[model samples]
Target chain A: MAERVMAEAVFDDLIHPSTRLSIVALLASADWADFAFVRDRLGLSDSALSKQFATLEDAGYVHIERPVTQHRRRVRVRLTDTGRRAFVGHVAALQEVISTAKLGARSD
Target chain B: MNGQVSESEARLALDAVEARRQQVAAEIDVPGWYWWSVAAGWVVLGALATFAPVWASAVGTVGFGALHAAVAPRVISGRRGSSRLSVRRDLVSRRVPFLVLGFLVAMVALTTAIALVLDADAARHPALLASGIVAALVVTGGPLLMSWVRRRAVRRLSA
Candidate 1:
């Protein structure tokens, strides 16, 4: 009836590219990683890792904890149950993209 | 154990501190262009069929039917660029709904098309309607489903 362009907006609910990569890598490989561990693996600065972790934590994809010793405070991070599920989902989405049979891909 | 009661306790202690850093994801919803692309594809096919039904029918196998079905799963989930589904079990578990949705939509679309072809006054035919409806439904409903599931999962994680 109406002549207009239609597009599927698949990027809406996704985590950022860098953040997602870091997240998936972290969630998929180890059950938990410390702030330092993630920072080292992702090659991110302290503030950068902090920013990313904050985002993930807010979205309920990660569980963040801080333990204080005699005086020093350290952070421990783990993939929440939701985070694990999201990681699984994220992997599936990637599979769909890679499914040439499903995508009519020409240049596989 | 020095600064905190124990490693576990310290870990627990840091929970709220790190969690408070979470911010609302700016790109936490599906995109829009993908919807328009599919719609455009269907409209083009409809136009082609109007001009030469036979030619459209032939190409439609690949372009209209196959191409659309091919990408439906990806679009429906609104996750276009994930890179970790190599593990078979992981892939299958998450895509159960997607595969099921694909089959259901195809069956429904085919049934509707067949009905239109058989009906005398179906007006405009069912091919166009079916394609457009499937695309729109998946684009809208798919994300809603994901959003609902994500919230549920988040709640579970919190517990």
Candidate 2:
């Protein structure tokens, strides 16, 4: 059944890590966010955020824009289509796991 | 047993996702500067309507509209915040502009109605009085109204 398949959904390790997951979740909610915004919100250092962004960008889950305006550089990030799909799947998988466990508990 | 443990972890992850989404949603608001500018404009327009000649008042209104049009894209997008984060487009309902516009129209109409009533009562500076009232609303009630509108929009869009 579809339920059985859903219950067996695979967890994406790339997105399962807490910091990455948090970043993806935040990005999933918006079209684009600035680098400083993401860093401040996540309470990550610039280098730490950059590292996470590099990981996601390498996976093609996010797109980063660096533009120079008024001689100042700014970075903006957005979840790519691939990233959004992956995030949706991950959430569904999480929900499935929870639901299946609840069902098992009830039956027992 | 493993399944149960995985399920617990999944539940935690799901909770985190929801929390992060909520945090993003909370951050989706027009900057304070935007609100302050709008409030100032409202007061100025009110003053013009009260004291200016008919042609001058008309010009002022048109000028205000033009200024609003110029500034609207930023304000109505509901993307910018006091912080560096811009809200994601998917989370923002397309109906936000319409809601804001409707609110503005209502405010204008209410202010005009108040001015008319005060003028009929021979109140001094009726336009200024009306503007004062509406300016107060803009300063105090603007955020609350935006919050209510945003909640309603999210609920409706989700449904």
Candidate 3:
């Protein structure tokens, strides 16, 4: 029961925001993706994507790289190990919350 | 942050996770060049096998297989899609290699069966005919087939 409570407490506020959660979820599946790809997929404006990237970067949840390819600069994003851990924990916490709710409803 | 999360919010969050995962799965694709190269290679190899001497054809087959083995790993690693972003290693299904191998085996078997059937019909250049048919399939359906296979693999992994 104590473990259940601790597990429920593992929700990550940093990743709880919908936009940030979406970003982390996408990054969780790939090693790295370009900025344009994420923006296009998420249907976010360049500025909006950049702002989200900055927020995740500040939290050390994502690493951004700007590399020049054939004289063209491109930004790439990837989830950090710490970010992955946080996302996984938050997901587990969410699952726990749902399961606990289901159990409580059944008891009542 | 320590406040209790409501059941509804938790369910919503879980839905978000699934949605994001689906987005990633949808993005799992080999670059366009992969399909095009495969099509070209199929035609080239088919032509070579049709025209070359048996020894030469054997050498070509071995050489092409070796080249594919060497280069295909980099291309099919699911690292990069049409976008500049590289996919994460964990998200990539380990069954990818098997999927590719199975696809190749099926293609080879189809080509061989076509050749045998045409040969039985006394058709001239049965091998060439088989190659043309297989090459056409590769050009037209390779990408779609790859996409379908990747989706299935992702579904299996997620399950």
Candidate 4:
């Protein structure tokens, strides 16, 4: 399918100190990843990852399914439909910013 | 870090860059005194190959391949680790991908050089010439790539 309009909202979405981008990039590389996996990959402290996850979940960008198996805390992370859209758009927005940043790089 | 950001980001960035630098160094695990000394051996081997073509090719192959294995890591490390500035550390920090790219380029150059050396007229082979040009360009283009990476790190560092 053709991409949706890569608008200004995507840029606005990225203007945050949140670890959300790390979450998106990590999830984008894999279909599903455990919290511990992300924690190690991003090297984020427990509280920082928790705070960012809360923000992202509140925004409907992520779907957290807590499937308990034998007393294990398995918080599996997957991008929601809205999340995939926002992430693709967000990446396109960043690409736009990079290409148009006037370091003489042309639009691809 | 600007003496403001948390200790973790600083460390993660360090891990990201160091992982690849370490790989580049590790890949070229070779003996001492063999890198600069190989050129003399190569000339003698190159002359011998005109008579015993097969033996010559084998010797030349082992000789140059060894030379590369001995020197590749050093060359890559010298370019990447030249800077001491903290800002540069950030640029090199997440450079595992670049190291992979460098490895790929090395493979391509090595194969092409081998083929060129095996040709009847080694000096006239385009593969050899092309590989030389590509290697030179990569060595020269390093600063340009670093400058681009440096620009990104500077932006991230601005916070």
Candidate 5:
């Protein structure tokens, strides 16, 4: 698959919150993650994780799927292309912030 | 968000991101069962060579090879090591399957060498003894190989 080029140094408000940033960072390394896996990994309660997922879903940053299996229903979460781009850009922006501060410190 | 956040906070967030990436990197492994099964199969093949007829031994080796071929493709990528998530291919080395296959081939050579040494010493059941030794290696060395893979993943992520 052809990956879209990430935008440069663009800060994203929707994803900047610590909780959401952690979620996105985890998902960025996976193709799809089980809800329980994300919840347990982040040490968040189901309701709390659901609330965060709902927010990200509304922002079109993530796609949630309920796959029916013989055992039970599973919620699988995937980062959307837009979300990946936003995340990549947000990380770049964070690095830029640090570098600019370093430059200012060097000048001073 | 960037405007209000201080440099130290950005650094911290970046650190957190790296931590999460490392967590995913840790997940890059073959399941524990895969190693056990391979080890068990190796021992079984060794047993067959020791006691079974020539045709039976040949068939057992071929059948074992077939089973391994079927299963290796799915697990060798080190992506689906857990039921929780399928790791992104970019997070794993493309050389994973090659590394695993290379390790197995080396094990085969080791087994042969051990068996030959034992046979020269006029030891009983040389094939069985050799296979048992290598099976132990498979169970132990397999996890070590994956740990090495995980370290490589962490290093690449940090880079």
Candidate 6:
């Protein structure tokens, strides 16, 4: 399938790290995900997941909400619009890198 | 340009992104309880049709329909199969609920036809027999339908 080449292909340094990238990529496909679910799915410890979430939250790329339900509080995470844009831009940037290298090899 | 990353590394990153999307796509399903409940209700309605008074059977059918209507909105998208996450609306087909409902409607029609044939052949408890057959199909076929949905979601993501 052809890649979706966005007009703005900005490489986001904050989201380039492997762990953060995985988290963002997962969130990109979900409206909102439970904190525990994300942690379990990625095989990360609570502390480790919290640390990553804090980094994303500080960057305005993710929002954390603690909602009360059934007399219990649950943590849910969703990517902000800014974060979604950054992720899309980052993916486009990655695709560009590959395509540019392929073009260079073909020219040679 | 991401000068620090080589072409192979960029490719790997993109692959990882796709993998994550596939993981979410895999979650496209209705909860197991939804199937079980529907199957049980079908059998009960069938039993009512066979042995109960006509009014009782009518009420049972109406009750089942009302219950399904109440619950379908939340589960029919095959998005909240798990409480962990709700699949993004754009990622799932909007017609999934309709597909499920349509499948049920077809089953109802099939049951009526089967019962008619059984009665014509002088079989006893035709309604019960027909409902049992359709209920079995519902229990087994529901999950298969959701699996097809998940595969479609993955294919859409890959595309």
Give one digit per residue, the lDDT tens place, for model 5 in A1-108.
112446777888898899999999999989999999999899999999999999999999999999987879999999999889989999989989999998989999
DockQ scores of all models, one per candidate = 0.03, 0.44, 0.52, 0.02, 0.60, 0.64
| Candidate 5 structure quality by residue, lDDT tens digits, B74-148 | 999999989889999878899999999999999999999999999999999999999999999999999999999
Name the weakest run of 10 consecutive residues (lDDT summed) in model 6 chain B. B83-92
Report the C-alpha displacement of residue B28, candidate 3, in angstroms.
2.2
Chain A only: TM-score per candidate: 0.73, 0.89, 0.89, 0.76, 0.92, 0.93
- In TM-score terms, candidate 4 sits at 0.36
Model 4 chain B weakest 10-residue run by lDDT = B82-91
| TM-score: the better of candidates 2 and 6 | 6
iRMS (Å) per candidate: 19.8, 4.8, 4.8, 14.2, 2.8, 2.2
Show where candidate 2 strays beyond 4 Å.
A1-10, B1-5, B150-159
Clashes in predicted model 3: 7
Q: Provide the TM-score of the second chain in candidate 5.
A: 0.94
- Give per-residue lDDT, candidate 5, residue B80: 91
Q: How do all models score by TM-score?
A: 0.41, 0.83, 0.86, 0.36, 0.91, 0.91
Q: Any residue pairs clashing in model 5, and if so which?
A: none
B25-139 in candidate 4: lDDT tens per residue? Answer: 2222122232224433434444444445687668776876786677655444322332110111222334634553474467456646664665646555444444445444444
Task: List where candidate 6 sits over 4 angstroms from the true fold.
Answer: A1-7
Sort the candidates on DockQ, descending order: 6, 5, 3, 2, 1, 4
TM-score of candidate 1 against the unseen true structure:
0.41
| lDDT per residue (tens digit) for residues A1-108 in model 2 | 111112235567899898999999888887688898889888999999999999999999999999787898989899988887788777777777878888989999
RMSD of each: 19.2, 4.4, 3.8, 14.8, 2.5, 2.3
* CA displacement after TM-score superposition, residue A55 of candidate 1 (Å): 19
* Candidate with better DockQ, 1 vs 2: 2
* lDDT (10s digit) by residue, model 3, range B97-130: 6766677778889999999999999998888888
Worst 10 residues of 3 chain B by lDDT: B78-87
Cα deviation of A87 in candidate 1 (Å)? 16
Q: Is candidate 1 or candidate 6 better by TM-score?
A: 6
Error of 1 at B114 (Å): 9.6
lDDT of model number 1: 0.48
CA displacement after TM-score superposition, residue A102 of candidate 3 (Å): 2.7
Rate residue B127 of model 6 by lDDT.
Answer: 92
